[model samples]
Target chain A: MADLIEISDPADPRLADYRDLRDVELRKSLESSEGLFLAEGEKVVRRAVAGGFEPRSFLMAPKWLDGLADTLATTDAPCYVMSEKAAEEVTGFHVHRGALASLKRRPLPSVESVLAGARSVLVLEDIVDHTNVGAIFRSGAALGFDAVLLAPRCADPLYRRSIKVAMGAVFALPWTRLPDWYEALPSLSAAGFTTVALTLADDAVDIERAVEGVDKVALVLGSEGHGISPRWQHASDRRAIIPMSAGIDSLNVAAATAVACYVTARR
Target chain B: MADLIEISDPADPRLADYRDLRDVELRKSLESSEGLFLAEGEKVVRRAVAGGFEPRSFLMAPKWLDGLADTLATTDAPCYVMSEKAAEEVTGFHVHRGALASLKRRPLPSVESVLAGARSVLVLEDIVDHTNVGAIFRSGAALGFDAVLLAPRCADPLYRRSIKVAMGAVFALPWTRLPDWYEALPSLSAAGFTTVALTLADDAVDIERAVEGVDKVALVLGSEGHGISPRWQHASDRRAIIPMSAGIDSLNVAAATAVACYVTARR
Candidate 1:
């Protein structure tokens, strides 16, 4: 069972991981370098625990400590119980969810390994927005995509805002960064995957027609401002466009990803 | 042609609608009053002009004024051309897109009128997030969903963030808030439409089956934290869920809306 430690001081050294989380520590560089990830709210924390992310420590309101007793029994991490005011002060914001867990970052598997057993995967190119990245992962996880492959310039999926928006699905989904995007495409093709680049280009086939009867597919999505890169357009085995209204160009990248995943996964 | 009116002062009363927009005019409340709606970027501004939204005025960088010569030829609104730095100071942020248009809010069409010529429509239930609201509209427009119907509590589709995130599709798609959600469902069903509610409940039918061969359908989406209300659940002609992984409960509402819209609008 985890040790329940009572913390009255906002400056306690043991609470360093959870301190200033809304400001200093919440910055992506700080959180990433410290190898710590935050799981906010009770539900996501519970999922994080279940996903094999061992909690390093927890900062919770005294009221929430008792409710988490059963889940805390499975881990040996210290649980710091504090007043809501003190917890909020220490965290640098109003902690509305009443509970938070800090877990050590697990090493990611290689891109090749994440794709090895996957039938459908998502390839994100230059998707810099954390919320969009998280939403993409959430959609990918929910829609049965086996893995998410991030190209260079994509936002860090482990960033705090990404994790919060993703509802902890970032921990559950298999994801990895590819060093060379164009190089990664041929390997996927060699592994019997069809590289389908999503674009708004005029000559591309409709997405419905492109995905028909495909067993294994990789759906490539791009940033909102720029669609897929010219390099990706050249490397793609096939190009498909989501059919849209005459005046509108395309959907948000994350929303577009969900449609692509759903359509391709349906087959 | 829009009259060129160069302004150097941030305190000018004429620029009040475009002043402190990030502060005084909350995106949600911007539509409640006679306040001007903001359209950012050249493309969105062009779309807004093309969609017949009468621009009250334009705040733009001097460089952008030259680029917008063709678009400005047909407009009668004043064009406040300023340096990029002055534009930034007036807008309280860097105007990266170099142009913005302020338009008077047009009266929304009646829900009946919006649905009159529609085949596939999206009914949003209290989706308050501007980004998600924008994203859904973008998806709806792209997927050829004929119109979008919002419940009372849903965010205004004309909100600046929604318009920007939607890449200005808020201007392209036909949308209006229904008089009441409960009353709208039955009327939709009476209008030869199949009312399909997207839910994650165990008893819900698969979305694939629910949308099969439907001529006209209303795809209902709920808010992020809460799924569709029980009232909506009860009123829906059919309940359907997107197939998802066991651990993940559902997709982000906007992403899910895209999937549902794509499924229901399949040719």
Candidate 2:
């Protein structure tokens, strides 16, 4: 059974992981990386527990503790029960959901491991927006994409905002970082994957026609402003574009990813 | 030629449309049904002008005015040429793109007119996020969705942030408010359209298999927290859901819209 501790003081050192969340908690410096990965709200916390991420500590209003009893019975972490007012003071903003948990970050799977036996994959190039990254993962997981591979510049999928925005899909979806994307491409191709680059260039085949025959496919998506670089474009097996009406630039990168993933995945 | 008016003072009455944009501009009630529709950057401003929403006025750095001279020749609106500093003060933020245009809100098309001859349509229910709404428009337009019908709770697509995020697709896409959604469904069915409601119910058919071979379709998407209301669920001709992994809840509304629109549109 979990250790239930009553916390009335907002300055408790054990509550440090949940403190000043809107500002310091969101920081991504090397020092803050030692801080716990925040799982906000009851739904995500329950998911984190289910995913085998043992909670170091939990802070929540007393009312919320009732709903979490079943999950808490199996955990050895200390659950810091606090008043909603005290909880708000420790955390910078109002946490309306009345619950939060901090878990230690675990080692991510390697690209090779995630890609093993995968038929369809999404390779993101420098997707900076956390929401877009999360949305892409949600869509990828939903549309039957086996794995997601992130290039160096992409936002961390484990980031708190990304995790929440992805509705816990990030926890279950297989993903890994490829520090050197160029070198990684050929290995993916050698593994029987057809590399499809998504771009707006004139010579690109219509996405509808591009995915008609390929069974094993890797869909490459680029950032909103600057698309996939010339090197990747040149190395791609085929370029596919979702046809648009004239005068429109392009769909949001995440939206485009969903369309591409849906089109390429087998129904 | 556009009348070139020089303004140095931030408090100038002529600059009212651009003042305190972070606060006043977002307040819909203050606009008195004649709210300013802002188009930022050179690209969106040009598109807005070409789309026939006459610019009421413009605040721009002198350097940008010279580049826009050819396009400005036909407009009668006064072009307020200001120093970069003054433009930033007037808008309450740095004018990074060096240009901004304020246009009067144009009348939205009637639902009947927007749906006329539409083979595929999207109905958005209570999606209040501006960026999500904007991305949905971009995806709908790109995927060849002929029209979008919005429920009353939907955000105004002409909001400034939405226009910027949408990259001006809002101006190009056909969207209108459906005041009477229940009443509109019979007409939609009468016009040979299959009303497909997207949900996560256990009995719902897979969206990919459900949409195939449908001639005319209306894909209905709901907000993030609450899925489609029971009213819509009961009214729909078919209930369909995008197949998702076991632990995942659902995709972002915009991402789901893209996937649904792509699957339902005439290929």
Expressed as tens digits, the lDDT of each residue in A137-203 for candidate 1 is 8888888888888897888887767887888888788889988876877777888899899997767
Error of 2 at A107 (Å): 2.9
Regions more than 4 Å wrong, model 1: A1-26, A60-63, A71-98, A201-203, B6-9, B23-27, B81-92, B201-203
TM-scores, all candidates, are: 0.88, 0.87
* Docking category of candidate 2: medium
- Candidate 2 scores a C-alpha RMSD against the true structure in Å of 3.4
Residue lDDT tens for model 2, A1-267? 789999899999989888777663345552146745888888888888888887888899989988888878878999999999999999878897888988887777788799989989999888887888888888888878889999888887877778888777777778899867776667678888888999987789989788888888989888877988787777778899987666556778888888888778752
Q: Give the Å shift of residue B138 in candidate 2.
A: 0.7
Give lDDT tens digits, candidate 1, residues B49-148: 8888888999997889877887788889999988888777887888878889888887789987898889999999989888889988888888888888
lDDT of 2 by residue, B6-107 (tens): 988988998877877677435455443556678888888887888788889988999998778876887989999999998888888887888888898867
Best by TM-score: 1
What is the alpha-carbon lDDT of model 1 when measured against the actual structure?
0.84
RMSD of every candidate to native, in Å, equals: 3.2, 3.4
**Clash number for model 1?**
0
Error of 2 at A204 (Å): 2.9
